[model samples]
Target chain A: MKKTHYSELWCSSPRFWGGLTFLAFIILLGLGATYYMEHQGHWVTGMSNQVVWGLPHVFAIFMIVAASGALNVASIGSVFGGPMYKPLGRFSALLAIGLLAGGLMVLVLDLGRPDRLVVAMTTFNLKSIFTWNILLYTGFFVIVGLYIWTMIDRKVNKYYQVTGYLAFFWRLVLTTGTGSIFGFLVAREAYDAAILAPMFIIMSFSFGLAFFIITLISAYWWAGRTLGELRLAKLKHLLGVFVGAVLYFSMVYHLTNLYITQHHGVERFILLDGGVYSLMFWLGHVLIGSIIPLFLIYSPAFASSRFAIGAASVLVLMGGFLQLYVIVIGGQAFPMNMFPGKEVVTSEFLDGVVASYIPTTAEGLLGIAGIAVAMTMVAVGSRMLKVLPENLEDPKDLEHA
Target chain B: MSNKDDRPDMKRREFIGKTVLAAGAASVAPGVLLTVAKAGGESRGVSSDVRYGLLIDTNKCADDCTACVDACNRENGIDLVERPKGQSDDDWNAQRPQWIRKVQLKDKQTGEITNLPMMCQHCEFPPCVDVCPTGASFKRADGIVMVDRHTCIGCRYCMMACPYKARSFIHQNVAQQLVNAPRGKGCVESCNLCVHRIDAGDMTTACQEACEKDGHQAIVFGDLKDPDSKLAKLLKTKSSRQIRADLELNTGVRYTNV
Candidate 1:
């Protein structure tokens, strides 16, 4: 029987303090960088004519996609009403809100005028993909936050059930917006396919499941103090399905490109020929990201343990970064025109065309700082609030936070 | 012809009377009367003649001679500081304006390299104007795509939306300017088609003038709608091309065949 004692246990975790300090340090660094950029200009970052987007953009987009995926637990529980996965509803909702907040901080810093972010909202452009993405993300965050609050409230509000369904649908739409930002460039032959939006949705599952599993494991080990055997078994099975889907989606994403030779020129050259992007895509995404994690998640013996699931999640996260690295940086690495002959001629002569990009030391450091801030928030939130329930209640009581 | 000739004189007197009568309407349209007054007493000047445009013959364009670039800088008070040959947007100051940029192209079939001057395409339905949230970027009725610097919040969405890579943000304060134009920091800027010169009834851009001075009518400016205008006649006489035609951007600037 769980004791009714009201003494707050969450605020006492050592991980909570450590995470908070790390996040604070990162926030301070980001503030310093913002001040420099505002005074100095874009030159403070490594973006130029050729490499228009640099490290912060790639990292921010990865986090945004990852954050959307991270909310899958809430989506599966609230919408699907899957009896087996109902236990993680509140945790998933909290994570979805936290990670999105962190991801937004990274994006806000990357803009030319961070202060003008309000202007982006006040003045709306119906046609711009970025504008649409902003609206989708804001709506997604609000609905998810409200859904979680209603689920956790003492009264067991029925309204959350409706919002839960809405959150699930909106996430699918949000991922599509992310994909279309790149895919809708009709003039850019590299990204003119219908597969990209679906690809983003699939990749999010991989990222979301991995992140969710890792967070659950961390909470069990250091925060909640216990995760029962039955819940563990169920999470492993759910992860297995997602892991399999991720593998299938990746194969289809690449194999389809190969099937259509006309569309595969520059993208194929980079993926197959070991260009700067190819090395990362093959090693980071395919090998480390997909294969090893898929094997670990499938293995019956290891899948049961928190350690194995956490390790596999680390690999999956690495792969997500590499995947984004390839899609964004690799996409830009080649000139817009896929005509090999024209590319050869232009690279030889034009000033900005053949220009290669690597994130500067400052950019890399600052981007890392952004990730640290999210980690800090999660740690602090878990410490200061009951982010994790202290004891596993019966599956019937799982509906309550 | 009689109707056209007689209306201008009658309207010239009537225009003054109408201006007095429409004083309240004139206040509502802050800059409308100024433009009407500037049109200078023609009931309708040749629509073809009054609305000027530019036609560039790519074949005759020189690889280098920035005479047009320098003249435009001098005429409009553009600042030129030495930027490193290649610096990324992240590393550059945020307020540098590159209104006119040079693009170097090489023939794929024949290994001949050439420089092409690139600026805002000034599209009939400009994507930049379509995508601007605050209406900072607008295409004037006279066919100039311009940014109102005061209203621009420096979001750089238009910069991302542009396919030609024509727009550049002002990355730094350029204190030493050539022509005493009101240049500011922290804004996206591109070629404004020399509105100051055009509004004063100038026939062409500084670049076009510089091209004419070199004895090659390489860059010709006139109205595309006017059948007898050089730009219209060139399009009619020759099969002209536009860069990145696959985007279907419907660019106002047309290139005579190379």
Candidate 2:
């Protein structure tokens, strides 16, 4: 086989410029919104003492989780020795870094005291899961950066396997850390289960693959290149398995919660009577995010159709956001049962009532900004760096493994 | 002769008065001596040996009374802020910082009503402290759970971790604040058990003082470790219980007659 070559995308086309401009505008608007929130204080946002984290966290967590999952393509090539996936590794690593950066930005900006981020970095509570996450997140960038270097530089080509292995392990740990952020919260009934760690790992796989497939198709379409049917078919199958796994985990999570009498209230709130939360869980997460995607990827006719698969991917991404909203916001909405058998007749801090949250314009902008930042990074990175393969078409001389 | 006698008497009386006044002033000139008598001599750090706590008797707490809550607000300078123009009353109620609140509870089956002031329990294993990424939410040596405002990034993780819903995040810029309890926007705070007053050697918190002042005396504040202290003695004799004993946080505050 002839030596493979990589090239930077020529982003001179009007479409490319238009896309970049749109993302930039959204990012700028998001920055303006963040400024307004910081100046006016959190009172301007829908978040309150009751519902502390809002829309920004949902966007931030989605990006971060997907970022880790995006690296699976590279891991399969380098760690597992799949020749077909080798060419896609560079783009995978790049997207991973970009997505993580975008997510971290939103998270940092949404802090009650964004100014004290330096303090957060400097003063570490070693016991806190968040502290560990900070380390894991930063370490991921450095390790992945080196991994990219190993892939690109011929002198360091031999080290590719080592770096790839390291990146793969780090990604797993990073996603686990993210999952444990919710899982380890013993105070919240919805979060205390240890299964959340593995559940997030599975979620990352589905969401990340969906995001990767969408980005790959869009980028190739714009570059006027073709991604082969075989490659798309492989990714679609993997995504289907992941979606099924997520459904299984979710079912187990609910079943476990049901088995415990203490957790019945929280389980009931999410699955039954809790209005918006229940709908988001059932319709958004279960139906659109998991079931539909599973059907699109597995059904013989739909599996071969690119449009159906693409639609499935987009739905999965949307479902990821809805799932996070249910977890983060819905968990807080349910009033904590401090007194088991007694009813709180009245209290100053709105005890015994479901906390309400309506995302403000500022919050919505901030969330969109995270997505824009990630997309902008990918667009600019692809343009400037030799990240994308010339073509994904298999050579006639090379035999299928 | 009469004038001479009066002048001598006045001079003698002035000399004796000056000597007594000077001696009195010398005895307590630095005021450290006065504190030494009250605090058992040399000024020292808050000791871990003494876990400051409150023993609340819900049976004696009046349903209509809000003296403890009122006093806590006044003492902490948690004054009521006018709701933002478009903000609903419910939103404002949730947003407003409440270090202490009066709760009225009724048993589901028995219909037994009880009134009590609920605030930060100051748990020994405080979830807020454990969850704080920056150690901003901390438990003092004396077991008073408080936030280090300077380090708190206002992530509200502490609020999420708190089981009792005791923590409050300051949502807006605080215009009116007491010098003692310096609150601000974007930081999580809760009942610090009146840390400032505790450090100043005040035996009772503002709530306890107000409750006693109202002649109810439903609350008793003292060291939990000292066997002779009222709180410890009461715990030994009375059927007092921690709010959520199942968590086994060993909260500083205990309640009797629920």
Candidate 3:
């Protein structure tokens, strides 16, 4: 018998309605941007032949990776038998589906031919990792949906562990497929490294947990429900460990590249002097995204502070977004080395030069819209389903109240 | 009894059998042993026996000459494409589709400069074809790599995978287009080695013709599989090499004296 009693969200605060309305406005703006950009063609955007994918990709990719990570909390409780995480299982599963939906929405809308999405579903090249990803992503929804059912319905509750295990493994493969999409690109010097697969998995853990904490805190606060401090602390610790692992993997990835003489130019371009890219990598990703978050979670001064935890989560998301921007856009900026020992003096195709990319207003709006869609789904779903628990207050605090 | 067994009738039977066997062998051998001849455009489908390719002599190609590039654009209807509104010349130039372009390379060791016209290498094992989600980017029976725009979802994964940076994504609304070369927005495309001309039995390519007309004769287009063709003979005699040969793509296009 479960000790926790799950209940539908009943917060009738006017602020809640206002927040939902704001998200809807953002979503509409995003759709408008997509429509205008598509109508004018890709020429209206910063993406060119040189820089194929832009800011939209950065958001979509991060959200998709994070979606897989969000399910980890549920998996820990059901599959790994963690008592503290049992109450979070339903919401975790819900978020996994919600984030994926939002991510896929952005990705599809940004396609050169969004109408031809039917073609993507109908025709497939098995050799392509992208095709595999489509299956993985769709399977994630079905499996996670079923997993949620087992958690919700008493009749199917016995099958929770089976679905939990399946969801856990599927999410692993799904994130791998996403990472391999870049890793399989042999032409790009920044990619083709096998470490990217595992790196993305760790990235999912960090970004997903951060987003999860933000959602948990905000939802509880909005509902005027007390969230236990002990659980938040545990989540903060988990996020710190994930962030540290991501840093370690990033270090290994860069060090391995530096060892290879052919990859030296790309390394220097990304880490040292590649202006915007270098700043994003060292400052945005490393300092603000990784190191600062670690400090907030670990230091005695701020570790226990709820405000600090929220700030850290938001920073992790910011860092993850920029890191992906570097991987997708910065990786393409460096010129491909076609001639082994020859220098391209001049070429009409901009060979041997860095490709420039500046995000348009439309792209920024579309990216943010995807995030709003994700949060909106979670909010609506919380109301519809008994996903969130009534109150996660410490028993002693409840007695005092 | 032995003498009777070796009679004239028995000897005649053996001789007749040998004669019939010899006659059958002589008549059926040609039909059974010979392979089918290499077919041209007259065939229902592009023949696998014929692999079209180009050979470029970099020594003869001059740095100032854009004849091949210009000719390819004009022949493929790429010259008719105009820059869209609100796009700068620099951005448009980078975004616009260029089937072929002039590439100038300087040797790292020696102060030697080499000029060449670069386009689709048309590798036998093209990475673009391997990565395409819809199998839109594919190779023909005659080893010509091209895109099927209808099936293409405009993902541009093929562009990222092409080591030669040959593929281009159509970015603007195509106001005008030639019947032979159908281009549109939201899809990727690249040099098809003048497949329209090939399908019409025109064996020569625009680039090869232009290079020859300029008296440089830098490009030679022919059937690489044909042992007697000039391309095959030149390849046999000269030290022609595929760019990035270390990848072992076995590209249809080869360059000499790079």
Please report, in order, the local distance difference test score of every candidate based on alpha carbons.
Answer: 0.68, 0.90, 0.91
Model 3 / residue A373 / CA error / Å: 1.0
lDDT value, residue A180 of candidate 2: 93
By DockQ: ranked, best first: 2, 3, 1
Each prediction's fraction of true contacts recovered:
0.25, 0.86, 0.76
Residue lDDT tens for model 1, B3-67? 65857777777878787879967686766776777577445333333444577786787766666
Question: Model 3: runs farther than 4 Å from truth?
Answer: A394-401, B1-43
Q: Alpha carbon lDDT of residue B201, candidate 2? A: 78
Report the C-alpha lDDT of model 1 over A288-354, residue by residue, as the tens digit: 8877877777777785676777787889889888878877767655555522334232221133343
Sort candidate 1 into its docking category: incorrect
**TM-score for each predicted model, relative to the true structure:** 0.83, 0.92, 0.92
lDDT of 2 at B179: 88
Error of 2 at B4 (Å): 90
Better of 1 and 2 by DockQ: 2
**True-vs-predicted CA distance for residue A95, candidate 3, Å:** 1.0
